[model samples]
Target: METIHLTYPETPDVVPSVMVLGFFDGVHTGHQAVIRHAQEQAERLNVPVTVVTFDPHPKQVLSNKPDAVRYITPLSRKLKRIESLGVERCLVLTFTKELAGLSPQQFVDDYLIGAGAVHVTAGFDYSYGKFGEGTMETMPFHARGRFTTSVVNEQTEGGEKVSSTRIRKLLGAGEVDAAATLLGSPYVICGEVIHGDARGRTIGYPTANVVMDASYVMPRLGVYATRVRLRDGRTFHAMTNVGRRPTFYDTGDVSIESHLFDFSEDLYGQLIEIEWVRFIRNERAFDGLDSLIAQLKQDETTARSILS
Candidate 1:
């Protein structure tokens, strides 16, 4: 799929296409429904399906506190997920202070009309404009004859709404199964493998330390059963730990370390994706190196059995 990182100057050249607009974090089931609706509309109109999303999530840009900057899928993963939905093109609007200041009418006039959107789709609760002044109530008026709008209702599972925030909370609590049901797939973290202290290597289980992007939401601190995909597209069963090495010292910095079973190769600087399947055990401090090694052996056995 084509990706366009849009600023004010780069307007879409396409004259008439069905467009879906949202942050689309996680590209969860609800976001998929909106995209699917847009795709069907595109099919009927004989036009390409375009997904319009924002970068550096609006909350992160607007918030004052550091902890407010959490995201379900980073930009790269977000693009990949959108592509997987069969979108013909993705327009990533760089969310700037000026863009955020656009009024409800100005946004439609500048983005929708300027970009040549024949039809637009969004979720039921979607809002836009400065301080979220725009709503479904006001969008159609702004569109007028220039475009048609479709608002998809929220997707629900187990009588609850499927949302990025809910999914993040679930994953943070080590509820992988629950999160998967809402996400329509396993929660995945894609990152580049970086150097570590070689703690796993000394124990005869050298690991790949996955350094995730800052925007990606990390799962709970625990040992998990996961599937690792290498840059060359090979998949392997793995056990991943997300925590600080409390036993060794109390630095308290969290890390994601993965031991790919039956695999031994230098993965430093390699890009990899890890798909969390299940949570096995919470992170804890062991007495010493011997105790930690013993626990790791037990963890390997449990992880292998679970994956098997």
Candidate 2:
């Protein structure tokens, strides 16, 4: 899919499309429904579906605590997910306070009607303009007879609305299995294999120390049944731990280390993706090295049962 970046006051000519609008952070199931509905409309109208999204998250610029704005899928991952759903093009608007201050009519005219949107599709709760004063209901009023709108209703899973907030809450609580049901896939973290203290090797269970971007919404600090995909597309069942090594240090920075089962090869400086499968146990300090090793052996057994 083609991606174009834009800022306010710069309107570029483009072909008419069935425009899908949202800041699709995770591209969760609900977001998928909206985009799929747009695809249907595009099929009927014989036009391509163009997704218009914002960058730096509006909350990053508008909220009092910008650093707290973590994401389920960061910009790069979100784009890949959107493209996997068959979106033809993407327009990423560089969000700023100036862009956020645009009046409802101005936003629609410049981003929608003026950008060659023949029809627009968004979730029911979608809104625009300064302080989000424009709702999908008000989209028609702003369309000015140049375009149409479709609002996909709330999508529910387990009797609750599927939302990014709910997913983040699940991840925060280490309910990755439950979150996967709502997300339609496993929660993933892409990171590099970095050097650690090389302590796991001493315990006969060498691990790859992964360091991901700070913007990712990390699963709760604990041991989890996980799958790790190497850069060469090799996947391995892993017993992953996300925590500070409490047994080694009284307190330290959080770390992600995964021991790939039956794998013994050098992986320093390589990139890998960790897919959370299920929660195993909370992180706890063991009495000694022998006790920690025993618990790790048990964790591996349980992870094998789950991933097998």
Give per-model TM-scores. Answer: 0.95, 0.98
lDDT of 1 at 219: 90
Tell me the tens digit of each residue's lDDT in model 1 across 1-308: 99989876456665679988899999999999999999999999999988889997886667787466777788988999999989989889998778899898888887788889999889999988888899877888989788888899889989999999899999989998789888899999888899888978988878898888556788999999899999899999999999997887678788899999999888899989999988999999988888888888998889889889
- Model 1 misplaced regions, further than 4 Å: none
Model 2 TM-score relative to the real fold:
0.98
Please list the C-alpha lDDT of all candidates, in the order they appear. Answer: 0.88, 0.93
Global CA lDDT computed for model 2 = 0.93
Model 2: lDDT of residue 276: 97
Cα deviation in Å at residue 240, candidate 1?
0.7
RMSD to the hidden true structure, all candidates: 1.5, 0.9
What is model 2's C-alpha RMSD? 0.9
lDDT of 2 by residue, 1-308 (tens): 99888887777466799999999988999999999999999999999999999998998999898998888999889999999999999999999999999999999988898889999989999999998999999999999989988899999998999999999999999999999988899999999998999999999999999989548998999999999999999999999999999999998999999999999999999989999999999999999999999999999999999999
Sum up the clashes in candidate 2: 0
